[model samples]
Target: MTTSAKRLDSAARRAQLLDVADRVFTAHGVHAPLDLIVEMAGVGRATLYRQFPDRHMLLLALMERSAQWLATRARRLAHRDDAFFRLLDYMASRIVRSPALSDYWRTTRMSDPRFSDVYQEVLNAFAPPVARAQRAGLLHADVRADDIPLLASMLAAGLRGETDAERRQLVGRALCIVQRGLTPSAPGGCLPGTVNDLS
Candidate 1:
């Protein structure tokens, strides 16, 4: 095979492995055996290690990829009048569909400071839309941008079903309830508590 073709093949294989890893990690969690990933990807152990030197590296890549995906969606919705709610819905859907990822985040406290930078980027993406929603009185005046993740987590907790369709339905119901609570009771009305109030 040509060198260029071989290079393409290598890139494709790496992506394929990452794709499999995403599914396996989501189904099993970050600490799941590498053998499951290799088996699912139809790749050998050497290939897995070659693509990702170790499990931590693989987990980091997965987390970064997931964060990037959400950030991209948030960016697209940034200009909408209800961007905050749209982003919340987007996150709720993702969490319900990827329960393993939700569980992983809940169970593992990311100790690495570098991961905080990624988290900050996501928070930044969420801020403008949240501010817009508050200014427009679509959301309660007391709601802070930082509260978005907590609200999303609460909604995500309600997701459950035997199948993807069922899970989506459950998440939809949960979001509906949460959205109603989030909406201002009257124009410019504030919720009883702000983010600081919780603390």
Candidate 2:
């Protein structure tokens, strides 16, 4: 094959691999076998190894994809006039939609330093919006940019209940408390259905 054709083929294979990895990782966690990913991706073992030298490399790729997915969600929710509230709503909706993300997060943290680096890169993309929200007096001024990750952890912990309804209530109550603390002057209490505009 010509060089150009070779490059295109490589790009296509990479995309296909990542798509399949997403499904397998979500269902089986990061510890899932390499053969499982290869089978799911419909690629030979040689092809998988050629693309990703080892399991770590494949996990890193998946982490990058997951981070980009999250940053996209945050950007979409950043449209509200109140940047702070919008960010909180975005995070709340994100938590509700993908409870599995926390598992991936823990896996990333346990992986190589490069994994943490990529995770931070993705988190940074969403930080500017949070900062802007704080500046607009919509988000709690005391809430530092670094606190977002901690907040995510706390929210995820609260959502670790047995039943879906219990998890939902935990998340809702956590968001309400956080929002209220952020907007003390607002007369009305945390009403349901108002926060998750981005959802």
Candidate 3:
């Protein structure tokens, strides 16, 4: 075959492997065997190794992909008046639907230095909308930028219902309750705790 065609095929195979790896990793956690990924991708061991030299590299790629997805969505909503809350809902929905991914995130520690860059990317994307919401008095002034993800996690916990319909209802109710608490209070009144006080 032609060199150009071979290159195109290689690129396609690489992307296919990444997609398969994403699903497998999310479903099986980071420690999942590469053999499962290779099997699911329908690719040879050599091809999987060529695309991702190790499991760590594959996990990093998945994190990058998820970060990029959030960044893109954040950018699209940045101009809206309620972008902060909208973005929160977007992330919460993702967590509720992707149980494995959510479990992985919950199990992983954010303080790990290797994930700092990924964390920063998400924080940067969230910062502007958060600032805008605070300025407009839509979100509580006491709510710092970092609190958004934690809040989403809290709200998404309601998704542990038995059925999808039940989970959807629970998520909606949880968001409503949290959003109400997030709304600005009367003058001289704020949320019960400062941003640093999670307890």
Candidate 4:
């Protein structure tokens, strides 16, 4: 065990690596060197390896962390009628800050079974809020549960930005466009009685 690993318990050390990996993956894209994660995390290669056997493991852990955060955000906004919109804002903020994370995420196709848990977690977290928003007439009735991921992918196009400010600007614009299209009263919300179950 490394000196740092010896100092922290297993759970603490694991969490430390994850937090460091999150920032490193944000700054450098997902393919950033593992040695850099070790250097920034102040842990030995063995330590990081012990916590995350490979880059994919680390990346999936980050995705799971994100799902948990969204779940928490949903719970926090449980009392608000605008919970769904607030959740969209929250996701947009994350995408703006760490658009680089989208690099690896894009590679993980939805058909890949490895991503099912994270995908399911997303559905579990957002489905109800989406339904509530539609029922309240805040969103178009044509918008279905699966549409959330598709909408998020559209928003995440901001990841193409060359710089942080550019990313924020692009994501902001994307969010505005998305919000307009999703709003029930908006012109582009949907066609009358048309539904897109995406089946």
TM per model? 0.77, 0.72, 0.77, 0.87
| Model 3 residue 7 lDDT score | 97
Q: Which 10 consecutive residues of model 1 have the lowest summed lDDT?
A: 190-199
- In model 3, what lDDT does residue 188 have? 39
Backbone clash pairs in model 2 (N, Cα, C under 3 Å; residues 3+ apart or in different chains), count: 0
Residue 85 C-alpha lDDT in model 2: 57
Residues 1-199 of candidate 4 have per-residue lDDT tens digits of: 8987776788788888888988998888888999999999888999999889999899998888888999999988877766787787778787876666665665578788999989888878888888888878888888876776787898888777888777777777777788888886777543322222111
Q: Candidate 4: minimum summed lDDT over ten consecutive residues — where?
A: 190-199
Candidate 2, 66-90: lDDT as tens digits = 6676677667767654654555555
Best prediction by lDDT: 4
lDDT of 3 by residue, 1-199 (tens): 8999999999888778878876786567567889998889877899888878897777776677777888999999888868887777767576555555655665566798877788788888889998998889888778887785677677667657666566666666666667777886633333232221111
Candidate 1 lDDT at 50 equals 87
Itemize residue pairs with steric clashes in candidate 1: none
Flag clash pairs in model 2: none
User: Which candidate leads the pack in TM-score?
Assistant: 4
Full-model lDDT, candidate 3: 0.73
- Candidate lDDT (C-alpha), each: 0.72, 0.67, 0.73, 0.79
Local lDDT at 123 for model 4 = 77
Clashes of each: 0, 0, 0, 0
Rank order (by lDDT, best first): 4, 3, 1, 2
